[model samples]
Target: MAMDFSNAALPAHYGLHFTPTFHSKIPPNIDPTSTTLPNPFIVVVTGAGKGLGYHISLAYASAGCSGLAISSRTSSDLDALASEISKIAEKRGTKIEVLKVVADVQSDSDVSNLEKEVRQKWGRVDVMIANAGVISKYVEAPSSSGSNLPRGIVQDADWARVLDINLNGVWRVSKAFVPLLSESKDGPQALISSCSMAAHSTISELTPIAYNVSKVAGMRLMECVANDHGEEGVQAFALHPGAVVTPQTKNHAGGQWSDILADDEGLAGAFCVWLTKEKREWLSGRYVSCNWNVKELEAKKDEIVKGNLLKYRMVV
Candidate 1:
């Protein structure tokens, strides 16, 4: 998993674990906002064909969420995941409905279809997980590996596609689904997009310009949504899912960082669920790392707000 530099500022007794169990339950007294935040009733996870997104779907299912819709470009993976979730729901005695939609993040028509299907099926959305993203495939880039290219020479086509998918795709999900999210029951709805450790810092050895730039922009976009739409009952967050082993990480053209990457299958998935289920309004509009001890993070709320830590600012 990616290192938790945030830990450096915390007390050792907090027991911070970046790879902590993802499915950990939120204590009933987690925060004062717990009563206002209802259990995740309807959820939509993008890039859910395999890997982290699939695991996140399972987390919500096991929580007995009523509705789940997972989207991806691959049809077979979605089918298998739907079937697996069905079995899990049955075994867990959670009456969860699973909807699998084959949709590519880069395609406008595909996203529209996704929104349409979810609204038609469930009529409301509690959480929208924008987990679809990509790393650039620049073969001639130069980095620590000597094979990657420099920022100046990165191809235009590659940069455009990466930004379109990583950043623009997230906005697409919010725009298409925000209406449904606003209609959620209880106090507020949520938007949690999958970001990366690279969004905070890039590796000189294998810098992925497209992925890095797009992630930073997307993270900021989430904050903007939170700031501008607070009265509309909208809650947004940018999340770094830790360096989990996945197809994108294990074999990215930029070189694999999956070696020291987190090996836990459910960390990212479980953390996302916790963020939505618990009352952590203080962390809204912030970049949240799955590796950080959220309880410790809660304890640091005073310092975090006083210092304006997670938000983007020039320190003016």
Candidate 2:
């Protein structure tokens, strides 16, 4: 069996091996509005209509990113997000060119259209966050009667739909954006995918098999990207964006799991900005959690590298 990266299978002292220190909000050091990124930096974020995606775009805009490309299937959501970003830019007295595109990750042509728009507008991409994802419909939740409902197994179509969006969708974005990342000259060319702690879960009652398997596979896929593109100065990472309450999770388990979602929604966005603020190649191809304390993580860099922790492997 694979020795997964879950808490039970790893050392406790390592922050990532256990539940990280809960950060309910963006810290001062990583606050985008306070800490500005370099000029001419352009970023592309998929699924930017709401939830984590919305916050991430806001964080980038607040940080004063020069160019921002946000894609969502819903045009109205994109319009609203663009307006909010404009307000942020005005408040900060920074000019951020916001590109709102209606594109679905599930469609090859739509993703291609997103890429074309970015290439035409800026001709390069400094950071790409493949954040588009979905949860399975067949979940274990509390029925109105207050009794634990039976966990329904995900159907074949439901399983395929999850993988198509969560795993294959990431692949589509990577294929369409890596060339632009290579063209970037003044920014950190980083590719970050939103993986999850659920990637390590085996309990079907807690997470659907499709979501679980897709995340696991997506983590490995990012590893492959790092290995394949590191020489090109393109750093890649798979990230667990912390346990925040999103539209997807607000009613998860019929609010039975609300307590776990108390984490700050903006934590992941700040973390992403920090991750790509500079090139720390040591962390490429690894799995990182947004909730991990940055100071502690920095202190443990040598040990982490020497031991080659924060990766997927099989233990004897």
Candidate 3:
């Protein structure tokens, strides 16, 4: 288990020290529905059939993005999401071309096919949201279970599967779509992946060991992407979409953490739009939480960059 660090003890820039008034909901400054994106902008979101993915796609459509390509493993879910996007376009007296694709991130062929389809339709991608991820069954501590059964990462049958989908999946999407982002005629090309605080937390009771390790490795991958691709005009970010409960989370350990999952589903979606809406290169390649107030985050820009904060590093 990791150390039991307290959020209140962390710095203001970490965003865990927010007042009661400014928790996890979407703030007015970065609300997508009230914002307008540039013309001819195109975005691709994976695992977008439901949950935070659905809301993120909706935010782009609400912001008047020119085109959107959303993918998921379920065809029915894509159909439902597409219908909602159409409704939003009509209501706002705007037009948004929605392309739906069915894909499993674990499959190389499926991910390639998704990239091919998007390239054929839009010829370029402005933003890529690699949001497909999965968690393994809980691995109880040896002390908790009476039997001497295996425990933690070594014991979980689905350990490899979680890393494959959560960590390697991010790599697959990045490998396929980053080139298209570079082809964009606009500014601020970005690749944002759904990450979690579990990357830094060691609370075994809250999540499985595989989930925690995959998140840590995933953030490191984001950092590597930023270092390698910043010269190519592609900015990458690891995003901790606020603690919102969806089908994925509700079933975890029979809803054990449901009480703490109070963030609005719209928070992360709006934050994505706000992140890539303009070129804030200073914040690229860092870990950001949707629950953080953007205004306060902006205020710490100089300190963040100067101190090289938010990226993982050894304390010693």
For model 2, how many clashes? 0
TM-score of 1: 0.82
What is candidate 2's lDDT per residue for 112-196, written digit by digit as tens?
Answer: 9999999999889999999999887742444443323223363323788889999999999999998888778567899999999
* lDDT of each candidate versus the true structure: 0.72, 0.82, 0.82
Clashes of each: 8, 0, 0
lDDT of 3 by residue, 1-316 (tens): 3223344544554446432345577778888989999988899999999998999999999998989999999999999999999999998899999999999999999999999999999898888999998777543544342222224555657778889999989999999988887777475789998999655655454556777888888888888888888888889999989878887776543222454577899999999999998877888888988887888888889988998878888877
**Global CA lDDT computed for model 1:** 0.72
Per-residue lDDT over 77-139 for candidate 1, one digit per residue giving the tens place of the 0 to 100 score: 999888988887787665778888999988899999999999999788888999987776645
In model 1, the Cα lDDT at residue 23 comes to 21
**TM-score per candidate:** 0.82, 0.90, 0.90
Model 3: how far residue 191 lies from native, Å: 0.2
**Model 3 residue 251 distance off true place after TM-score fit, in angstroms:** 2.3
Native-referenced Cα lDDT, model 3 = 0.82
Decoy 2 TM-score against native: 0.90
